[model samples]
Target: MLRKVLECRRCGYRTVCGRDDLVARLRIVGQLRRDKDPDESIVEALLAEYTPLMTCPGCKEVGLKANDADDEWDDDGDWQAAVLCEICRQPIDPERLEFLPETKRCTECQHKSETGTLPDEDPEFCSRCGALVELRVSRGSGITRYKRFCTGGCRGV
Candidate 1:
């Protein structure tokens, strides 16, 4: 069995690992144990919580978690933005989509539409975000159709 021991970096006081070991010990003993003093019978409960950080790790004095990097200030560090294809729900890198015009099929949707079947003449709307998708048709010797997404998000209300 692995034992957990917690030691404070600043203070000399040491504490036993509380979560993993305490949960395991509780399973072994039929009765619950009071986290407080013997006569107090008080149980101290700990749960997962969200803590927002506002500083950069490379330069800021405060520490940061993996996800905290996104919350960092724009001037201090890079901003992580979420980009999703208007047609497909799949994630897209913001960098790649930067140059793509507002009126182009996402790489995946484009490939699928080209290989399987041409999209219908009518404009389509994003099923998920409810954004209006515009399909442009060119009247060549034959019918040529192109697709584009609405500038505003479909769900805009």
Candidate 2:
């Protein structure tokens, strides 16, 4: 069975886990805390307590500089599972992966296949900064449209 695992982007450190392991951790957390905030979820509490303790083992071994001001060691970003689309071979958006972990295609590819449309092949450049532009696809009222914007926040300029 496929299971989600956290991998450090820089150091290639990985923490393998399964549903059983998560259930055990959740049980332990439940036992440790009796009075939790009504609004705070058990998973949030578990993450809050566990995030501080997570340090990349590979980063520690290689002596990489910690990004945090506190003694906690970490890279610029949090360790997360890097999910790539089977069609595009690009990193799938984290929000999309969070909702649909089994997705094989990215938003653009998925929309193209569903609507029988192809994305523009020619590269677009930003007018203000001359950087490569990215295409954003939007669908509304049974219509699909593509919008181009600069990657370097030059659209406002």
Candidate 3:
């Protein structure tokens, strides 16, 4: 099914809307402008009603462009790169993706998740030494409560 979606140009965030929903929203905004306040302009009413939908959920930026897209081929048909495992940050298997396109985890991660053996957090590696980085609580009164440190003790290198 083809549907209309509002996409943020800056952050690539998409908000899907059906034709009936869009029409209903426009009607509501028009009624609000007519019944509630005649002084309120149509542009003001539209912006007030659609500012949240126009704003990118990921980056909180405005300016959304409308586009018609198929449900299966959304995001410009770049399904392989678009779908990634939430746990391992790897591309999900194409077969599994075809079967369940909305899945967030890959097969291994999904199995581990279902078995309650999935790790709480993925291990971060140090850029300098390629060793595991550990999250440590800060002692001083800083903005961030926790900071990542290299386990191999590569101090500020």
TM-score of each: 0.25, 0.27, 0.29
Query: Candidate 2 at 51: error in angstroms?
Result: 34
**Each candidate: how many clashes?**
2, 0, 0
Provide the clash count, candidate 1: 2
Runs of candidate 3 with Cα error greater than 4 angstroms are 1-82, 121-157
RMSD of each: 21.8, 19.0, 16.0
Q: Least accurate stretch of 10 residues (summed lDDT) in model 3?
A: 29-38
TM-score of 3: 0.29
Better of 2 and 3 by TM-score: 3
Model 1, 115: alpha-carbon shift in Å? 3.9
Q: Rank by lDDT, descending?
A: 3, 2, 1
> How big is the positional error of residue 3 in model 3, measured in Å on the Cα after superposition?
21
Find the 10 residues in a row with the least total lDDT in model 2: 62-71
Residues 29-101, candidate 3, lDDT per residue (tens digit)? 2333233332324434454456455445478676566655565656454443335466665557889989997
Name model 2 segments beyond 4 Å from true.
Answer: 1-77, 118-157
Model 2 scores a TM of 0.27
lDDT of 1 by residue, 1-157 (tens): 2223323233333323233333422322222222323221111222111111212213433222222112133454453333444455344656567776453356767777778765553444455554456645645666666545554555432
- TM-score ranking of the models: 3, 2, 1
